[model samples]
Target: MTVAVATIGFTKTTAENFFARLKAAKVKRVIDVRLHNTSQLAGFAKADDLAYFLKTINGMDYVPEPILAPTEELMKFFKTDKGDWDVFSRDFSALMKERKVEKALKPSFLDGACLLCSEATAHRCHRRLVVEYLNKEWSGALTVAHL
Candidate 1:
């Protein structure tokens, strides 16, 4: 079976609660796809801090892969697409493959994995695009859950 992916929003959730829910879901690792791993949220700023909390405290693996960060070329193309979500989606799928998202998924291959970002709503973030691309192109069975 394909690995199940989830997206969790850490916007207002406390670290403790977040970890608890992740544990409950049996998440083996969390992939932070945010362009900026640093969070405005006081406790989640540094990747090291997040890693420590997830690994040392919650016993989960953490990987920061910013595949959704818009590059210069991507930005330019986006402007041409004129906010066409489908175009953005198609391009992102290609980018993910080029970036070897499959390789990145290796760690979580044996267990459930979740992506994380700052936005409380998945639909409002680039994560939705990523998830949709994975679902369509990579045949990824991902469910986005807002924390």
Candidate 2:
């Protein structure tokens, strides 16, 4: 069976809409993939609050998996150092390869799992790259949907 995975971003969205979307998608768990999930800008998506919200609101689990996140250096290069999308994408892909994220993760674990990030959408987001990388490693075992 194909492992189903979803991706979502918190920015430019409301708490009500966010939780509702997850519920609508039947997401069983949320995998927080942000390098900085505790930032005040995270608001409703903050680690502790998000965990509580997921459980209390959707009866879902929250897992912080920073290993899937881009490194500080990579983030800086893309956001602060003015690196292009192509460069960031290549570097982030290399980082994921070097880290062997595919081996670290199991398809079962990702089933019904949704990747969480700060961007408003998966386009131009590392979360998209992550799912793509994992799909490749798993020989197209994953069926990804961006929420």
Candidate 3:
């Protein structure tokens, strides 16, 4: 089964606690879907840096798949009649079909996969949309958890 996991809160999650939760979950990789990857958070600013820390420090694989990133076009669309969700959902599904996220996720999904972004609650983040798209469109089995 393909599982998509994501963190709920961003600013509140400490790197230590985040890593600890990931270890406990036995998550093999973390797929970051932030449109802008740079974060004020010290450890999660860069993809490479986060990946390194995930692997070297937490022993979990890290993969950045921006296809899941919410773009301006997506944001603009989402602001309208919830039509943006349709557009974003379509584009995201297309990206997955193209194997873009799958390709980037290659080694990571061998065990299990989780998506990450900077929101304290999945319901409050675009990552929620991505997770929904994955679970519904791709029929990917998913569970969202916070750390």
lDDT of each: 0.69, 0.94, 0.64
Q: Output the lDDT of residue 45, model 2.
A: 89
As a whole number from 0 to 100, the lDDT of residue 73 in candidate 2 is: 95
What TM-score, over all chains together, does every model reach?
0.70, 0.98, 0.68
> Positional deviation of 94 in candidate 1, in angstroms?
7.0
Residue-level lDDT for 3 in candidate 2? 92
Tell me how many clashing residue pairs each candidate has. 0, 0, 8
Mark the regions of model 3 whose C-alpha exceeds 4 Å error after superposition: 1-9, 73-111
RMSD of 2: 0.8
Winning model by TM-score: 2
TM-score leaderboard ranking: 2, 1, 3
Clashing pairs in 3: 8-119, 8-120, 8-121, 9-119, 9-120, 10-119, 77-84, 78-84
Candidate 2 on 1-147: residue-level lDDT in tens? 799999999999899999999999999999999999996765888899999999999999999998899999999999899889999999999999999998998999999999999989999999999999999999999999999
Q: Write the per-residue lDDT of candidate 3 for residues 17-128, one digit (tens) a residue.
A: 7777778877777878787677766556467788888889878877777676766665566644466455666665665566555444433253366678776667556777
Candidate 2 lDDT at 110 equals 97
- Candidate ranking under lDDT, highest first, comes to 2, 1, 3
Question: Which pairs of residues clash in candidate 1, taking residues 3 or more apart in a chain or in different chains?
Answer: none
